[model samples]
Target chain A: MGGADIERLIALLARLPGLGPRSARRAALALLRQPQTRMLPLAQAMEQAARTVRTCSTCGNLDTHDPCGICTDSARDRGLVCVVETVGDLWALERAGVHRGVYQVLGGTLSALSGTGPDDLNLAPLLARLEEGGVREVILALGATVEGAATAHWLQDRLAGFDVPVSRVGQGVPMGGGALDVLDDGTLAAALTARKIYS
Target chain B: MGGADIERLIALLARLPGLGPRSARRAALALLRQPQTRMLPLAQAMEQAARTVRTCSTCGNLDTHDPCGICTDSARDRGLVCVVETVGDLWALERAGVHRGVYQVLGGTLSALSGTGPDDLNLAPLLARLEEGGVREVILALGATVEGAATAHWLQDRLAGFDVPVSRVGQGVPMGGGALDVLDDGTLAAALTARKIYS
Candidate 1:
């Protein structure tokens, strides 16, 4: 029936995380054998999501509506804004359900290796929006990579004297446990170098 | 834009392979932020594939057509049939590019725990198909699990006194491996007991 079609399906699935050609082939076959009732709804969902989902014009977050629900919401604190390198990071913060403010997705961090810079980031617009909307605090929630650190520094410099309290998210290993085995050698070294004596 | 939509998107993406709520949330955010050209086409492809794909009536493979391409192919060796528990397994064999025979999908192995049996499987239909066709051999490409072994034995008993030869796929760990170092005592013992002298 759909030899070429199945091939196409496998190709698409292979692109997803943790799916190699072997697993993709397997998943496709399972889908093929499934009844229409099961398959159709999934298909519809995929179509609907694809057709309607769009980015928030204000903060570069994904949404079906402009400005997004968070931005439009009155309950959230308008003065506190979290800045992240990607929309994915924003979603993670959202799922944690801890933050009460809106977000600014920078699209990506400044990377010297990748030729990414301050201007390349959509930060100017975010800054402008902050100024226009009277934002008080900007929380940088970027990855703990070199690029991320560089970006945080860049943003700090850019927003200097703007009357906004710029704070970077905590870096290094987790706390309140035994020795941090998960912390990288560099972070561990840094932590050791900046260690404080207990009373 | 997609504040409420984030929940729905996360749920949907979590259902996909290798994506937990954490990963799904990230993916949704990524999609929301950029909505790039790559994303639109990928989404469209996903939708189109989902909309058209269906099960093959003759062989239980997924396809846009009813009989499926494999079943309809005149060039394939229909007499040498490979029996598999799932369409996914069949696809794995196809990916290996080793076999040129048609396939018989058992749907699942017999499991007393799950209350699955010969009747629960498509065995009757398979037997009928065998009777109606020119099948000379049935290759069991089932898993190495206990149920998979029992199913093979059951099939052997059912096809007693038949002319066709029943064979199983070879059992062993994949290449670039040594279980003697990593396997538990029981599995290592079993592997050693079942070891064959390869020339």
Candidate 2:
């Protein structure tokens, strides 16, 4: 039905995170249908990104520059650093427009089953940043999962020697959550435990 | 959080059939993570397909060659031509491996609401192929929709001038479909109407 090139394109597209074989084929066909407008531009963009995009040495964020924009930005508070498990999490925080400080991407969390230890993450650079001083506070914004808790605990133990204060993001009912009846047991418990007093 | 190239890649990817902005960003990040293994090869494949693929003049199928591999293949029966609405349909039939005949891709069906007409389809090459003679059968393997029926009727009216016999693919219960209770009214009607003779 198709030539080798088209077959290869479909196969490669199938390797992406959400795309499977059928969807990849559909995407390939959609791209092929408009070669000049869609396929060429996408190919050029991918090529350009592949050639230029690199990981930031300071914060483990991905950008074309070594230090990344957030690391080099003077306006953002360097004294307050938010530690996230992945770049995706950092992007999520940035999208929310709440964080006015820099980020340290751990790349991944520690997992016993996956054999991911503290060394597997970007902890060395984070420690180096802490050792350089001037950082006033460190915020652990990791997930609510067991691996996230384990990673945060390990980081807390390591950062105890430093002069900077460490804190974890508050856990409770989310901003747009529904009624307590619809909430899960863990979330309900967290919300009850972390309840604030009325004025 | 990303540069122009990465943003451009995400935007372009978001235009694909099943992907949205968030998924596209995930895909872009996945690609960027392994530039050597995933991104470069996909880019190269897209470029190659874009540069080499062309529409087959004879059958309207996409291939690197002029007439396409199916049209030029001596093993397939040239006397039986399966007319399909798109190259994707042709690929589907080919994947089934039930058809020993060649194909004629109509590119799209006739639609009054969308302003698609006979002139907009690949009817010229089809008529030309019929006029060249030796065509025993013309099978309409279009979708089971109003547009497909309209297109089939139009083709039947046009092929009235030709000597070849025109037929449509059967409409009935699918291969792996469940009981009659689960089937929709249209499909049930189709199945009952097209019921075969019991041995």
Candidate 3:
């Protein structure tokens, strides 16, 4: 009756990304107050997610099935593939709606300082997919960071002997973001270099 | 294969306090990534909490029992009752570790604008508790807001005819709260009025 259950719930919630101890406690109390409306449903949903969610066999993307929706879909462009650093990056690209191709998750970029290498990532899977033919282009949609560059370079060298063209998604001024006054020097330079003529 | 289970879980989790859509998605992905370590236990705990936790009959406190642990505990000072506006307030007092007594939850304070009166609150249980026996004091630990003041005043008027003394918890500069420059005028005045001699 001292609410040990609530305390345990709070402790568990504290491990979530955006919540601290105080916010966890608040969330716990909120959940407890609306147990029927919120707590039970959330609990059930989480249980369902735990039971069903798994990594895609082909792309390393998290899904309920091995091939994943994107990898198995016939409507998507089989000739094009977008390579991303993480699942979050893949989701971001999906939300942007500019790319209609499938994705190959790198798991993470090569970071020499962190002792991460090509073998530690999903390079084998990408190479395997490319080797099967029909994919004419591989777009590197990785970040502009040092590790991202190193990984992209390694991938470029790996696919150099292959006939398929490997290119990077261009970096420039973001949509509705960073005006002239607010844009940093590096971003400004990149924007200028990658500037496209308005069609 | 699109992990609809995980997405649904994220949608449900986003409804919780302190978590938005973005963080909910991140949390869902994180939980999926470590099902055994995090997700399963949290789901089980929420299920447990939903099953067992209930509002105490003796005091409006929520706990696993009819009479909350605080209300039933003989170790606590039964003669002193701390009246609070909400369960969150009760938890806050518990966290503060200053109160050595049980609590009576008002559910909410009296609000003229919202048309909440004494009858709309949990005053019946409190009155019944007061009439039954050895309670020597009732402390109103409600906030210093308008509704709080009105509720306190109403309680004071009702308890005037009773044998037990009814008091309000003093307001001052909170512990580890407010620099002189940052303190609002009302708080500054309250702090000044409730000033204590330095030990």
Candidate 4:
């Protein structure tokens, strides 16, 4: 229904995480409908990002700089590192403004079904960071999924030789989550087991 | 959490249909993660499409050519033209492979709430196509909505001066649709009204 260029655009857009072939066509049409305002700018932005963005050598995070802003930021506590499964997770922690520390992006978790071993993740830089030896704590901020837990256990075992302490993010009832009826079995169990005393 | 270029890419992606800020960020990260394979090609495709694709003069459909492929195709019947609300609708018809005629994209339908009137649509080109003559039937293949019906009525009235016959696509129970119990009231009524006689 469109030229090869438009078809190619749609096909490439379909490769994105959330977009499929149909929505990619819709997105392409929406872009074509407003070339000056949407298409050109998006093209320019993609081109710019593609040209400049690179993975950080120090922490496996993505940024234009080699060390990344987080790695170079003196104000943030480099001694307190948060290990996450992906760059998206790192962004989530940053967005919440809950972590005033540096981050290590593992790219992905160790999944047995997917044949993802410890070697598949960005573990070398993490070990290098630990070997440098000023880090007080390494917080595993991975997901609550099975693979996340497996990855955390693997990392904990690997980091046992180091002087730094290893800890996983607490699992319990979410801060703003609904009552017990809505809570899943595992979450309710964790919440009960981790119950704290009143002041 | 990222460089300026990455931020710009995410912001631009968020402007697309069916994508919000969070999904856009995820998309950006996906693109950034595979710059060589995904991001560069997508950017190139968008740039090429932006530079080449334009609205067809004969129809309102978008293509690299002036008159579009459908309008110029010798195999198709020029005497039969399908008037649709958008290029997306034209694509839908083409995907169905049920139409052997050319198309006239109206760009959009008339809407009172959105203040979209006849002047806002691509009616002039359609009239010009009719004035040039040889069109036997002008099929209204618009949506089954209030605005679509209103636009069809408006177009029918405007085309009263033309010699060509005007007809609308049939309204009935959809092909491969679910049981009658699941049909909405309007659809059920329409189906009943447009019921076919048994052979």
User: Considering every candidate listed, which one attains the maximal DockQ?
Assistant: 4
lDDT of each residue in B1-199, candidate 1, tens digit only: 3544456656765766565776666555545444454345445555566667766666766677777788888999988888888777776677678889888888899999999988877666557767786888989888878899899999998976566789877655445666557755655565666689989
Candidate 4 residue lDDT tens string, A10-95: 88999898899999889999999998889989988888888899999988888999999999999999899999999999999999
Across A124-148, the per-residue lDDT of candidate 1 in tens digits comes to 6577866786888999898878898
DockQ score for candidate 3: 0.67
CA shift of A143, model 2, Å: 1.7
Query: What's model 3's overall lDDT?
Result: 0.87
Model 2 agreement with the true structure over B4-24: per-residue lDDT tens digits? 777899999999887999999
TM-score, each model?
0.85, 0.96, 0.91, 0.95
Cand. 4 Cα-lDDT: 0.90
Return the clash pairs for model 2, or none.
none
Write the residue-wise lDDT of candidate 3 on A1-199 in tens digits: 3478877888999999888998888898899999999999999998888888888878778888888988888999978989999887888788778888888888899997888887899877778878888888999988988888889999999889778999998887878894687887877888899988999
Residue pairs whose backbone atoms clash in candidate 1: A1-B68, A1-B69, A32-B62, A62-B32, A63-B1, A63-B2, A68-B1
User: Each candidate's interface RMSD, rounded to one decimal?
Assistant: 3.6, 0.8, 1.6, 0.8
Model 3 in CAPRI terms: which quality? Answer: medium
What DockQ, between 0 and 1, does each candidate earn? 0.43, 0.78, 0.67, 0.80
* Model 2 residue A71 CA deviation in Å: 1.1
Give fnat, all candidates: 0.39, 0.69, 0.75, 0.79
